[model samples]
Target: MKKWLLTTSAVVMMGSAIPIAWAGDGLWRHVPSTHAHSSARAVAGGPFAGHADVQHDWQLRSSVRVSRQVLREAYLASRAVYTEKLQKYAKVTPSQAKKAIAQAHPGMKVEDVQLRNIRTDLVYTGLAQDDEERYLVIVDAGNGKLLLDRLLPTHHERVFSGD
Candidate 1:
């Protein structure tokens, strides 16, 4: 009985230790890390500042490869264009576009609104309702004109069927 009890305890301890060792190894193994010792070797801007292939081997190992400042500058530039176009056109507010989309869809609700520049025209794209019931409502960015308002799947169906 004494020998059997000792062997059972040893087996249980081994099983628990196996899982604990695995958990500990996984905790640190998958975590993203960078080994950059200093900023002296950082990439300088020309045209390929954030290209994945241009990044160092150490940087490629980590999730992020591009400079945050570069991304911020691009975002600010796009926002400036969005603001300038909205103010200059004075055609439709996002709220107005939402209302128009809601009216057309009856029970559906507008989930998101985005301003897109297609050629010289500013278009408002509103995603309405859920994923399955979603509709893509495109309106003139400057005049509140409904250019294209169709169910998302219907649009895909037409394209796939070569309609």
Candidate 2:
């Protein structure tokens, strides 16, 4: 009986240890750390400054190795806050923002102009005509800056395909 009890206790201990080891090694391993400086690169916020149609240019090498217009009129949706002194900095009406974008591009259409409370800095996803079909432009709200414009990758279609 003594030997049996000792064996049973040993088995119980081993069983508990197994679960602990599994938890430490397999299940709960590799959690997302919130440390500031873990040397991890910051995740890119959706291809835009996330504010307005801020314009920026970047050079891209063509398949033939020649430089070409890779991006243009990238739009981002952002929240714009106008402090007490800068009333112009205050809130730009949606119509006002639309006019600004049109004046910049001259006959460019703004698509998906969603005004949310959080990203209210005048950043938005806009549609524009370029070399490709429809460019999802990242526009800056405050200054109507075109941050980036490019052909969206085909990978997005897969996500919408319902696999």
Pick by TM-score: which candidate is best?
1
Off by over 4 Å in 1: 1-77, 154-163
Each prediction's Cα lDDT score?
A: 0.62, 0.45
How far residue 88's Cα lies from its native spot in candidate 2, in Å, is 12
Report how far residue 122 has shifted in candidate 2, in Å.
Answer: 4.9
TM-score of 1: 0.46
TM-score for each prediction? 0.46, 0.29
Q: Compute the lDDT of residue 64 as modeled in candidate 1.
A: 42
Cα RMSD, model 1: 21.1
Q: Over the stretch 9-105, how does candidate 2's per-residue lDDT look in tens digits?
A: 5554574576586454333344443554332322344223222322222233447432223111111101121122233443554565555545555
Model 1, 77-119: lDDT tens digits are: 5555556656556578878877788887888778767776678
For residue 100, what is the lDDT in candidate 1? 80
Instruction: Report the Cα lDDT for residue 56, model 1.
Output: 32
